[model samples]
Target: MALQIISVVLFTVFFSEALTLMCYNCNTTTECTQANCSSSCSSMTNHNGNNITFVKKCADSAWCFNSSINLGLIWMSSQCCSSNLCNNATVSENGLSCYTCNDKDCTNRLKCKGGEDHCITATGESLQNTVKGCASKNICDNITLLNNTLPQQHLSSSCCRGNLCNNAQKMTQGPVLLLVPILSLLFYILGLF
Candidate 1:
């Protein structure tokens, strides 16, 4: 009887762990349709990675930061949930709008240049050693700055963005289906004991 109970507990733990692990690695393709300016706007991928081929139309002399831009297609790894996990991801800089993961660090940090141009000060004086005119192009740039400047930085692009938010949805199907039967059997055996 005790052995049966132990088996049920073990099965429950194993099922939970497996489900958690699977969920960690699961990737869902969420469409940013609202950001799509035109009917032709569509995301595509190649051997490299995901790409946002469409470019947002720039209005007048004002350079459009492409706030509608797709930052990058991030695939959350199995270790994403843990504290020591490699949350380090990537972002696209070029028109392709993609990123690559070599190690754990995000390869492309500079996306749009933020429309800020840093030039040498005219004075060339020792007192004017510091570079100036380094300001953000968008409100989002301020958030990125905060992430870089702060110590305990928890800057997640998936957080604020609606619809595309990766909130770790529960697995309604897949191997979890197998776990259900196993769990039921374990419970039945426990009850018999």
Candidate 2:
């Protein structure tokens, strides 16, 4: 009986599996969820020249990419790995540079991280604040759709290739002065679904 008990205890200890991992979940209120994930990680990017990050615990075989979801016009860049609470850190940088400023002239410099290869410039009718930053090509491609998706006021976006292409100043009164794609993406959250 003693030997049997020992064997049973050993088996239970060896076969017991961890229930779940703690993950930082984004919500209106700060919350955490026990998730079945081998890794926890975050997605990071410059939005209107400011860094935006989202954290989530990820399953196995996860990879990273900057992708746009048309349903809610959700643009996401996610990086995943296989470690507990691994998503807590900032995503790796992608070595791209662009001029950046928010609610002001584009005088500040921004570091483009992840899959953001295109530089974006934007101005809105109501706010009249010029926003500049780096973005994925998809966000730059469908400016009309983006505007329509988040329409309370008129917004405009211009996307350009090459480093620091958005560094130049524009005379707002002239159409000929506007260059590249401007991303007024935050007219409000697009596709809030």
Candidate 3:
């Protein structure tokens, strides 16, 4: 009877420990994937099928750019301005562009040239800002001023704790060990009753 009780307790403990380890692995894996996803998306560039150009001077003291594209319906053009003076700017062929200005004077202005398509305009103010202009057949889309920001640092502390992978592994082991003893105690009491 004692042998049977010990075996049952060991089995229950082992099973619970295994389950706890699995849960921890799954949760941490998901967290790691999300962190990676956020990292990747933060660095995403333009998509494709767009042309952007940089303009040195504008009516305002802010930096500006003119983006033009032929999207099969009409030729569209957009002028985007940085809130302040030019600091950093990026233009890409993938229809994604961004500019950063120094202050709040950054304003983005867009216009659809030709075809009587009724000009569209949008504006923004920022310490540093960017703008995206998009055009498609039958529709003219202009993201006058858009902001491209760097990702916030959140994982520094976690990473600083020795190796992140090793820490995660150690954390995962805790839950497994915790569940094992709890399950063993529960099983032992049940067997006693």
Q: Compute each candidate's TM-score over C-alphas.
A: 0.19, 0.52, 0.16
C-alpha RMSD values across all candidates: 24.1, 8.1, 28.1
Judged by TM-score, which candidate is best? Answer: 2
Ranking according to TM-score, highest score first: 2, 1, 3
TM for candidate 1 is: 0.19
Off by over 4 Å in 1: 20-86, 94-193
lDDT of 1 by residue, 1-193 (tens): 9999999999998976554311111112442222212112211111113432221121221221222212223111111112211122233323221221222222332222222221110111222111111111232333344334332323222113222122222222222111222222322332210
Q: Which stretches of candidate 2 lie over 4 Å from their true place?
A: 1-34, 37-54, 58-89, 150-152, 170-193
lDDT of 3 by residue, 42-98 (tens): 111111224322212223212222333321112233333333322123433432222
Candidate 2 per-residue C-alpha lDDT over 1-193 given as tens digits, one digit per residue, 9 for 90 to 100: 9999999998887665463444555532356565554444443322222334344545344334333211011234444444566555554457777776532345556677655778876666755455566776655666767667546547676778888887755324323122213222332233111
* CA lDDT of each prediction against the hidden true structure: 0.24, 0.51, 0.24
Q: Look at candidate 1 and give me any clashing residue pairs.
A: none
lDDT at 77, model 2: 48
CA lDDT for candidate 1? 0.24
